[model samples]
Target chain A: MYRVALRMLLGDKTKCLGLVFGVAFSTLLVCQQMSIFFGLLGRASSVVNDVREADIWVMDPSVKTIDVPYPLRALELPRVRGVEGVAWAVPFFKATVQVRTHQGMLENAIILGIDDASLVGVPDAFVVGSIDDLAEPDAIAVNPAGFRLLFPGEELDVGRELELNDSRAKIVAIVDAAPAFAANLTIYTRYSLATQYTNNGRNQLSFILAKSADGTPPEVVAERIAARTGLKSVTSQQLRRESIMYVLANTGIPVSFGTVVILGAIIGVAIVGLTFNQFVMENIKQYAALKAIGVRNVKLLFMTLGQAAFVGVIGYGIGLGIAALFFSTVPKKSDALRGFYLLPEVAVGVAILAAVIVILSTLISMRRVLTVDPATVFRG
Target chain B: MTTATDTLAVRCTGIHKSFGEGEARVHVLRGTDFDARTGEMTFLVGPSGCGKTTLISVLGAILSCDDGEVDVLGHDLRALSSGKLADFRLANLGFIFQQFNLLPALSATENASIPLVARGESVKAAETSAREMLESLGMGDQVHKMPAQLSGGQQQRVAIARALVHSPRILICDEPTASLDAATGNTVMGLLRDAALAGDRSVIIVTHDNRIFDFADRIHHMADGVITHIESPDSSREDAP
Candidate 1:
């Protein structure tokens, strides 16, 4: 009987293809949009994720996201260092500056100043030069992507020089830093050199990066620092979550992506429901014949469900394959699309949603099959 | 020796059935009494809307009557629930429809195997049985063809094979020859007649085609929701009061 049901579905090639296409289209749309949405959210907190050594970040009380930092006074760093359970603390400076390339092109760049002694907040991976090179006078590290922007068509060599704040700066290293939300050029230098380049009045400290002692959780140390210094302190993970939440609360990205996902589900339901119903309607007499020939309604129900499951699995497999291909290839080929990939959680969630769409459509069509009179088969 | 009443396959007394209600009410079966004996072919002949199909539906246990004593193959149909009734039908009865009602997607052997498959037989075993039945009906070369690929006579042969594949105790057919021409209809009727007298099985058919009247052992003429008379092809006709 299940074989019979499958044959009946496959016999009508057009309707079967239509049903599969509806599910596949919906799965692709929902998964692709959701992956991009999560990818963008990840970019919102990329800076926090890149500085892996810092367990705690202390900033001014008003800062909500990593992109919009409110600087704390220089004295607050010593206070944060003085707090109990604090293993080490260092000054971290972040400021936007304009860089003039040797070719005379000007672009905005983010300058991150790490502690001169520890180099604590610098990116760990370097593509061109060693970390020791930053100790050289007027030396700085630029991310590979930022380096590409500043020196188009140039090889990733460490000898490139740029003018920052009318001061000569040499790029001694090309680091593989996590991409930022604005995708601006990122330059890393020593704290004192960064202060000399930026004129931001007296309080120039953007954040105090700290590490908690052994057996002390970062959240507890952050609370102690917040109570003692009267500044906002958060664990790295907390900051990453807060950064993503801030974007979700303040931006239109959620609504825009959410609308596409919802529309995808709606279109999936409409297409599957109408096509499945028509398929049932066209075969109502055949169903009646089965019913008259001693096929119980329960058996018929299972057959219908079997057909729905087949369509759902096949369609979802095709859709997920396309989505995975997009994530694998597109990010590597385009600079702007870098760091965006499909999440496993998003894949599992979309699969459940696809199952729901298929099951809902099947249940709706089952009603007609269950209610048809077997006597109608006698009516010719 | 088995008496005619002792071998009765179906017995219905004062069966009443109706459709709709209030001013639109239409009574389809009005206190009708009917019977079909084992080892015989019983034909119910009537015009459209005269309740021949309704009576057969009741005898087939696919429909419920308003009030009646309905016994088929020695079991009281009224005592069975819908689920049990379905089981009984699958175990004991087979049906042939007016349009043949073969599933278009299935090949002739697969269509003919439905009753056995519905009764929990494995598809392979059922198809094997159906193939033998089809070959017996002279459809040996058409077993693998789809319904659309077969002629009307071939489709009807497949339907007959489906009806007899399970070796049902009673076979019910409604308008089995309506869609076929004279020669094809006669051929189908001959196959059905052979199936009826082969064993203790009883075959009941409701049809309007009089060309094949000679195939029936007994014919019940119905009018206005009641059986008007009974005709024996080998003897004199008897009128009802």
Candidate 2:
């Protein structure tokens, strides 16, 4: 019967191919868009991911995502370091300021101030002079992407100078950091120099990046720091999740992607449903003959189910394969598409969604086959 | 008190059937009593809309009647659940349709193997048996051809092979030769008569083709939802001569 079902389904080449197309198109659309949406949300917490050495982050209680920084008073760093289980703490400064490029164009930049002595928050990768060069007066480090944005098509080199908040600043080193969600060039400078450059008042510290002592869990130390200092202390993972949640709550990204996914599902149901129903109707007499010859309804039901399963698995496999290819191929066009990959949970979710689409499409045809009278085969 | 004779393949009594409702209602089978005995080919002849097809449909248990009784192959169809009735049909009955009704996607051999498959035979065994039957019926060369590739007469032979492959006791055919030429009709009728009369099997054919009337062992004439007469082929032939 499964052989019979396959032959019958494949006999009509157009309709069978149409069914596969419907399932494949939906899987590709929903799965690909969802991955991109996830990747974009992940960018909201790139800063948390960039500073790998910190076990926990301390900030003003109102701070939400990394982009929306609530500056802490400089004195809070020593308070956070004094808490038990705190191995060490460093003052971190982040501020948005305008910089005048050599071309005289003013561009927005995110200024990151690492501790002067330890250079603890400096980017992990350096394309030119090492972190020691930051000791030079008015020295700063800029990432490649921000450098290009600040000076389009310029040759990569150190010693590029620019004006920050009316103060002269020199690019002594080049950092290879990913672009943050704020879509601004990131500038790394010494803490005091960053303060002078931004020209903010004395309480310019944005956060306290802390490490846990040996044998002390980050979560416990974060709890102690929060309880003692009356400030928000979140482990790296917690802060990343909070940043993602903030983006989810405050933006329309989910709803926008959600509507497209729903549309894909509906289109799949419509195309596959109509095509399968048409196939069954065209062969109604043959089914009636089989029914009349005493083939049980359950057997026929399984035959239909088997056909749907075949179409679903094939369609989903092809769709997912193409989606993976897209994720691999699209990044070459731009750097923004970097760091995108399909999540395993999303793969499972899309597979289940494809199965549901296939099942839903065949239901009408199954009912039609079930209700048909065997006597219909005898009719003129 | 109905009795099932050892030779009786079917015993249907006072059968009633209707179609549609309200102003469009039609009582297609009105108090019809019919029977077919083992080792005989029975032909039910009637004009269009005379309820010949409907009567056989009821006898085959493809449709339940509005009233009265149908006992086929020793089981009262009304007394059996639908599931059991389906099992009974699979085990004891077969059907042939006028259109040959072969699944177009299947080859002639596969189409003929359907009844055996319905009885839970494996594809390899069913096709082996179907091939032997087709070869015996002179369709050996056509077994692998799809129905669309076969001539009408060849297709009907496959239908006949399908009907007999499962060794069913009762075979019902509706307008079996209405679509064939006179010579092809005779060929199909010859095949059917040979298959049905070979053992304790009974065949009931509802048709308007007069060319194959010579093949029937007993002719049951029907008119306006009633059996008008029952006659043997020998008696009809004597009358004709």
Candidate 3:
């Protein structure tokens, strides 16, 4: 029975290849596009994740998204410290400004300045150099990934310098592979440098980064700060949503990605459906003959579904693999493509759509299956 | 219930079937009675679309008659549920279609092994039995050749081998000789004759080829879904047990 089923599925090379390719194309598009999109989103909130490092974050008033203005880091820092469950409170600086580099005037860099003493907001991985390098005045940390982009495949020494703001900053550290998602070109500087860079105009930080002591819910600390400081506080998980909510609502990203997703799903279903329908139509006689031989209906259905799954899984995997390879090798300067980076949850969501399309497209032809009077084979 | 006729391979009476509903409804079979006992070869011959295949499907348990009594291998077809009817067919019936219907991707031996494997036999044992059946039909050397690799005559022989592999009590063929040349058709018909008559089982071939009529122990001609005439080699074809 398996032999027959195998024959039924791959009997014709043309049809089998068509099915595989249809699935492959769909997989590639969905994976590659989504990877870059999510990669960008991760970058958009890099400063928040870096500075807070906390289980929770509190914002000013009813702030939503990391871009929202918070009360001066000086004023809220003490109020958060006064909270019952509070273990630690620190100031974080986030702003975007143009930076002068060898490549060009790179604009809208998410500038972050962690307090001079703490250094809590630095990139986690450093491909080259160590943290002690950031200790020097007029010194800053640069991502090796960015350095490589400005000077491809070449290493820059610590003494090398780039001018940002009016201050002449020397690169004391070259951090390798620090891929901060969005801030792939990030340069780490002291809080004072950030103050001078932005001219101390606002005189306030983005928000506060806090850590709760043992066995304390971040919600408790957040509520304490909200009641005492009255500067609306939120947990890190809530901050993550707050960080993304504005960009999602204000920007046209949802509409754009939503359109692309719909197109991807439609094309996926159409290609697979049309191609697989051809496969089944060509094999109709074999199915009829199998029915004549007393092969049960359910078994035949299983074989079809199994073939579909084979196409879906293999094509999806191969497509994503190819897409990922393409994305990884892409120069950072290229239009930000993360290439279908998704967690298990995202993969499941994508599959639900594909599976429904497959079943829907195939179900239309099942009528022919059920109607296949075994007598047709007897006559023909 | 204990009559000696209980040993019969097939017994049917008053089979009725229809298609569609209300104004579109058409009766295909009405009060049709038929039989093909053990060790006999019965041919149900009719011209195009006269319900020979439909009747065969009903007898093969692939189709259920609307109202009838059908007893095959001591199991009442009308009484069994749809699933059990399929099980009965799997256990006892072997079918060959007119088109030499072998799965294209599979080798001839694999095609012949389908019934046994469908009945849940292991692949190893199934192919072993398939090889034996194919060898009996002179397809032993071509066991591993896909359907495309074999000539039409060889493919038909493989089909015949498949129908007989499970040692079914009833072997049913619809136009088994349709695609073959006269010589090849005769060879296939001879294999059927030997398998049914010599082995004490029954073979029913539904074909209009009068040349193969003598190969059957009994030939039944049908027109408009009713059996018009039935002639047997000997009246004692279904002798009392």
Candidate 4:
């Protein structure tokens, strides 16, 4: 009986292929868009957690996310280090300054400050003259991804400086692949280097990034830290989702994806329904013939639904394969596009989508197939 | 009145059928009484619009007579529910349409085995029986042919083989030879009569082709929704001349 339905579909390969590709195309469009959208949300908070590799983030109690507060001082670091589960605590600094690029001065270059000793916030990409230059007072490091945007052209060995708030700073080591907080155009300097130009003193600093003691739950330590100090403490994961939601909610990503998923489901209904309807309609004569010779309506129904489900299966398998191949071709720098997790999430999502497609369309076309008049077998 | 000559395959009395009512009523079969018996081939002969096909359909349990006691195999159709009637049709009767209706997607063996397989026979057993039946009917070489691949006579042969696959108590054929030439029609009629008479299973063939009158063990001539004549081997009109 399954073979019977398959034969019917294969009888018109062109039409069946048209429908399969139609659904596959729709699935690819919707799933890739979702991956990129979630990837975008990931980008907005990548530096706040991923770069620092922090287990917990301690910020002002009033803050919902890491971006809410300015850089904090070395004084709070001591208070946090004394906490039971705290292994090491690092104070990150955020300072906006006028960057004098060879192209033009850009205003929103987010300054990331970490002292040279632990360099807890600095990633391996730090290169060029080196972190030792941070001891040179006015030197700052910039990630290579944003290096060209910050320094547009090659000028002679001359003094080019960026002024933060009031004071000036010089370029130091260049890092590679390191993430930035606000936008891609970022400059990193030592805490002492940034402090020279700091107008707000030790009071205005970014959240404290912390690594917990072994066996201590980051959530439990975060709760303790928030309770001990007047600041709120969130695990890096919590802050990651919160910071992402902070940005995504503004961009309405949730609403957009909700719409796409719903539209995806409806498109599934339309594609499978119309396709199955046409399939059964074209093969109705065969069904009448089957029925007249004593084939049960239930058997005919199974054959019809079996064909629809087979299409769903084939289409989903093809679509996911295409999506994986597409994702693989992307270069490593495409962090935004590199985040498709085909494990539990996509497996469940595609399963739900395919099942819904099969079940809905089978039921829609079932009414027609079941009511077929067996007497029509005599007509032709 | 039915006789002890054979168990009544079908008996319809006061059968009335109307498509609509009042001024729009198209009475297809009105007050038609008919009978088909086992151990004989009953030819239902009538002109177009004479309701012979409708009467045959009623006999086959495909369509119910509106106001008649249609008894098949001693079970009164009006006394049974629709579902029971359908089950009776599936279990005890077989039908061959004028079109030689066979699922084009199915092979000749599968097509012939539909009734037996559908009634819960194992596929392997049904296929074997169907193959043996087709082989006996001289369609052994075309067992794998689809309906579209077979000639009209071949297709009709496959239909007859299917009708007898389960050894049905009665076989009702509607114009089984309508689409065949004289020779092919004679061949098909011979196969149908032999199938009916060989097993003592009743057979009713509804057709207007007078050329196959020799195949009939009994003939009920119909006109204007009425049985106008009953012909038997001894009293057949062909013997009068």
Question: For model 3, what is the error of residue B200's alpha carbon versus the real structure, in angstroms, after optimal superposition?
Answer: 0.8
Question: After best superposition, candidate 2 residue B103: deviation in angstroms?
Answer: 1.6
User: Per-residue CA lDDT of candidate 2, range A280-348, in tens?
Assistant: 999989989998898888989988998899889988988898898888888544556766777777789
| Candidate 1: tens digits of C-alpha lDDT, residues B75-140 | 988888988888888889989988898999999999999999888899999999999999999999
lDDT of 2: 0.86
- lDDT digits (tens) for residues B1-241 of candidate 4: 1122477778888888776778998898888888878877888888888988677767766667778678788888778765566677778888888887666667899888877767777888989999999999999899999888899899989988888898888888888888999999999888887878677788888888888888887788888888887888666553210
Whichever of 1 and 4 has more lDDT, that candidate is 1
Ranking by lDDT: 1, 2, 4, 3
lDDT of 1 by residue, A62-162 (tens): 99988888877788878888999999999999888888987998988888899999999987899999899999999999887788787777788988789
CA deviation > 4 Å runs, candidate 1: A104-106, A151-155, B1-6
A290-312 per-residue lDDT for model 4 (tens digits): 66555666777777778877787
- How high is the DockQ of candidate 3? 0.52
Give the lowest summed-lDDT range of ten residues in model 3 chain A.
Answer: A331-340
Q: Candidate 2, residues B1-241: lDDT per residue as tens digits?
A: 0111348898888889999999999999988888888878888898999998888888887788899889898888888777777788788888999888889999989999998887889999999999998998899999999999999999999998988899999989999898899989888888887877674688889988888877877778888898888867666432211
Highest DockQ: which candidate?
Answer: 1
Native contacts recovered, in order, as a fraction for each? 0.75, 0.62, 0.67, 0.28
TM-score of each: 0.96, 0.92, 0.86, 0.82
- How do all the candidates rank in terms of DockQ, highest first? 1, 2, 3, 4
The global C-alpha lDDT for each of the candidates, from Candidate 1 onward, is 0.90, 0.86, 0.73, 0.73
> Candidate 4 clashing pairs?
A70-A205, A70-A206, A71-A204, A71-A205, A71-A206, A72-A205, A72-A206
